[model samples]
Target: MSMERIATALDRVSAALRRKPQAGIHDDAAATARWDGGLRTRVLHDAGHELLTDMPAEIGGEDGAPTPGWFMRAGLASCAVTRIAMAAAAEGIRLETLEARASSRSDTRGMLLIPEADGSAVPAQPLEIALHVRIGAPGVPAERLRTLVEWTARCSPVGCTVEQPMPLALHVDVAS
Candidate 1:
């Protein structure tokens, strides 16, 4: 879809969430760790009394352009970075290219059930990831730089959560 269309759709989703009452968000501080065969997942909330997450980059994403599935992928990507960027920064790592793409594999029986995940491990959710990272500070050695990335992945709240699920939930979505 055109970027304009995506923007409009994102506007609507954002508007809807803003309209929700603050008291509606529960837990503010609680969640669970999920394991499906091999993939790991986590459901966390510092919703802090807010009903939704503060990922403005996404809620304001291309309107219905993302369809719900695409939107979820965006969130997955955003959160993946959200949970790791700090670690990279703390280590004083300089990053140039950091791209993580998520994939899904679903059975003929049912797909698209991931969004319904209520703070639980949504199998086949982000089935595979192709990560391309380039980091080289003025003085950091390549080997040491690689370790920083390893540490990031190790502490990646979302990716690390899904390392063991066999056949994990793998599916793809087509924006209609």
Candidate 2:
């Protein structure tokens, strides 16, 4: 969509939101994942979109698609960029270009069930996840842009998830 169109759409949404604040309330979302075989998995959403995840050949997978960690990083980057765009529109900040990157260092030994020399399992968590955002809006003060990026990180869902621990539950069932 054109920039003008996006601005118009955001304006319409803002107007409607102002008119009826309750119109923006949402409570729940659902998605599903199915394992095909080996390390291959397919994630399905109610919106008719699908994502494939797999492991690399070194980890005993055929390398059919990206790993789950890659998807997580991609999601963080995409969500950050999207939220930044929406916030910029709401604040009437004209941006010529925006870029976001998410990255982390992780040990796969535990995930792959590899034992250390001391017969201990390596930690499976990423050391840290970093987000980098670059904005190109001429004449805009660098301080203000930096503040906007920081605000975007605070408001983005994926960014929050990476920064804080959220409640999660899991259940296992067997198919007859």
Candidate 3:
């Protein structure tokens, strides 16, 4: 959609949200993943879309698809891009170029369950996640674009979730 349309739509939503703040708080549909075989899985979303994940051959997988960690990084990049674009549109900034890249460093020892020298458990999460964003808009100040990117980082849902600690619950079912 055009930036003008996006601005109009965002304004409408903002007004509605201001009037009924509770309307913004709601649960999203759950995504279910089913194991397909050795280190491969298929995830189904509520919208009938499916995503596949697989480990490399070294990890006993066929390498038919990308690893789950890859998907996580992709999600982060895409979410940041979307949020940045939305903000740009709302602010009447005509963006000529916008790109976001997400990268992380992880230790395989943690996932492989290798024992540490100090006997401390290795973290399964990435050691660091970095997002590099390149954006430009004709006639817009560089500082303004930087500020927009910074604001988008704080507002991006996936970014926020990854940055903050939240409670998670797991349940198991036994089948006969």
Candidate 4:
């Protein structure tokens, strides 16, 4: 879709949300992941969408699909792109090129629950995450693009989620 159309749609949504603040609250459907085999899982989402995750052969997996961490990185990249596009459209900036690249470093010992040399606990999360965004537009200042990218980082859903961890509630049920 054209940026003008996107801007129009966004304006409509923004007006609606302003009129009814509660309209901005979104409750997403639950996504369930079932283990397909060793170190492999199949996730089911809305509209019959399915995603698969598997570790490398060295990790006792078939290496058939991307790992969960890869998916998280992909999500962050895609979400940043989406937010950037939206912001540019709203601001009437016609982008010639836009890209977001996300990368992270993970410690295997942390993931495997291996204790440190001092018998301390290691975090099971990525040690560092980085996102590099490239954006270009004709007749637009580079500083403006930088500001837009910074704004996108603050507003992107996945970016925000990764930056600020949320509380998770886990429930387990024993099957007969």
TM-scores of all predicted structures: 0.40, 0.85, 0.97, 0.97
Residue pairs in collision within model 2: none
- For candidate 4, the 10 contiguous residues with the lowest summed lDDT are 23-32
Off by over 4 Å in 4: none
Per-residue lDDT over 94-155 for candidate 1, one digit per residue giving the tens place of the 0 to 100 score: 55545556555443213334443365545543445444454446666878767766777776
C-alpha-based local distance difference test score of model 3: 0.94
Query: What shift in Å separates residue 59 of candidate 3 from its native position after superposition?
Result: 1.1
Residues 1-176, model 2: lDDT tens digits: 65567778989998999999999998656668899899999999888899999999997888999999999999899999999898787677889889998999987886767889999888787868898899977788989989999988888988898899777787889899
Each prediction's whole-model lDDT (CA) = 0.49, 0.87, 0.94, 0.94
Q: What would the per-residue lDDT of candidate 4 be over residues 5-80, giving only the tens digit for each residue? A: 9999999999999999997898887788999989999999977999999999986899999999999999999999
What's model 3's TM-score?
Answer: 0.97
Worst 10 residues of 1 by lDDT: 48-57
lDDT by residue for model 3 (9-80), tens: 999999999999999999988989999988999999999999999998986999999999999999899999
Cα RMSD, each candidate: 16.8, 2.5, 1.0, 0.9
